[model samples]
Target: MFRRLEEGDPAVRTLWSQLVEISLQEMFGIFDRLGGVTLDYPKDGEAFYQPYLGEVIAEAKEQGVARQSDGALIIEVPGEETPLLLLKSNGTTTYATRDLAQVRYRAQTFHPAKILYCVANEQALHFRQYHAAARRLGFVPDSLELVHVKFGLMRGAEGKLSTRRGTSIFLQDVMDEAVRRAREVVEAKNPELSDREKTEIAEVVGIGALKYFDLSHDRRHDIVFDWDRMLSLKGDSAPYLQYSYVRAVQILAKVGTVNFPLDKWKGESGRFGVGLPEDVQRLVRELARFPLVLERAAADYTPHTIAQYLNDLAGQFSQFYECYPVLKAEGEDRAIRLAIVAGVANVLRRGLDLLGIKVLERM
Candidate 1:
């Protein structure tokens, strides 16, 4: 699964994916050197490295540092013919041996500013030892940035998702289930609505709920999946933000002819400033912080930061909408307030979208 992520567009989900790929590649090399796995994976505890691992062993041999014997690939250590076995005396390769090859390849080729190995928290010791082996082999750089990004696991109510027991809840399944539940809720709330309308609304509510639930927590913390919490119409769930967007839309429907003027607002400073009441002042502040929030999220690789920002923005807009009357206000204040609300609604929805959440125009 981790290896599959390396070949995708960069996203929050892919960061950990590449890290796991690198780690597993190294482990495969080590396993190859040891006696290869005789047991099957996840059953008898037998593990084997990914295929095409011979390339690394072949490269080592060409460099006059390794030899192949009895179907095993071995590399010379500092003092002895005691080869770092890459493959088992049997034909199979091991996880550790494959990983050794991966490290060797990266040091020689990638030369990255940093090679971050994102793994689970428990593998810290394994990473340290892996780096130590590299240093000993005179293949690793002292100045190379070798980082391990670790995190806790997500658990369901039953327990940690277990593929072994066929109990692991897939991400796709979670998304679909959320949508199904949202549809149910919408049907209950608005029985007069058509099925098509309910489905459209449910798509936004469901996807929003899933993304918000996953991102609201810090990555270092283990998450326990709760259907009720994730699908809640209140609290910090996606549905709350969606409902907030819906409220903004309702207000806009009441006030006609609101223009965004995004292009005009750009490259000019202080010219577009409009007077705002205290209630709307808070909303404007939240809207203006959109770019800053996005920058922070991208810089820290934290999607949750963006999620939290949108939630706060939504709350602020909800308050402003309730307290101020956009359509009933006199003179320019009405137009300005409408514009501000519309702009804020756009920003909030966009931010939520980046987090893979959806926005609903109506509850």
Candidate 2:
């Protein structure tokens, strides 16, 4: 005889909970090590909404939005030829049923003004139908904003990474490989450092590279997983930005503590009156644009905007560093240049942090 699946079934429930816990722990551990901000998983919607499925179906039917078609409960969605199936002939609820229930539950529980769903581009139609059905059934308010943030596929050199095709790369393996490769580079460049320092630097650089590569691209564009491009110090990669930050830190260290006179530098044009060099002026202008860039990134839901800004800022700083003298300069010129360096370092740190990439003091 078959047994009913219930929470009281200790044998199945305990094992399933343990499995989910273990997987979440592993994923969170890797993310934490990579300097990513921690996030809590939402409550188990599947279990919480199962009992209320009948109620949702009944409501849909009462509202004349859902009807039986070919042994399935379907809701006719606008602008679509096919109706959204809520329940199959076998009495099993579909994903639409769960999602509709989730929308209602969230609306009642949180009363959020907007909800964003980040899923693959392939699920565009499904979400459109789901949102339409939710609105038609009065589960979601007409004013409630629903955004679908669709991202493209991440493919390997062979093609799209798939578990069934045996081309999938595990997160742990990717992290380990990144660290291993980074360690090799670190040992070659900074062999004089202690083993511990090398290991720490490797971890920072490796994880930063991975994050930078992912965040530096437009989400809708498909990306190829490339190691050389990601780990390189010469291009618009994490190492390049880290190197720039380290250079700025080194300059600040040599110049001692800088006390920039805010009132003296203030002017009607917002430009410093310290007779700043053109390159220094350029760097300052770029630094000032950080806030606007961050705003745009948030509005667009694009981390790549920040990535591009950091890359440009780093490039400008590089130019300024090569063109000017910070340590040996005297009086106002030195102070102004040092202040610019400090600003660049601060902006770089903040930008990289927003992108979930770690910065290194010395690299």
Query: Whose TM-score is greatest here?
Result: 2
TM-score of 1: 0.66
Put down candidate 2 lDDT per residue, 186-267, tens digits, no spaces.
9998999999999999999998998899889999888999999989988699989999999999888876776544446556
lDDT of 2 at 157: 89
Number of the top-ranking candidate, with lDDT as the measure: 2
User: Candidate 2 deviates by what RMSD?
Assistant: 2.6
Task: Provide the lowest-lDDT 10-residue window in model 1.
Answer: 42-51
In model 2, state the lDDT of residue 344: 86
lDDT of 1: 0.68
Q: Write the per-residue lDDT of candidate 1 for residues 160-188, one digit (tens) a residue.
A: 87899888886656767888999999988
Give every collision pair in model 2: none
- Give stretches of model 2 more than 4 Å off: 1-15, 42-45, 259-275
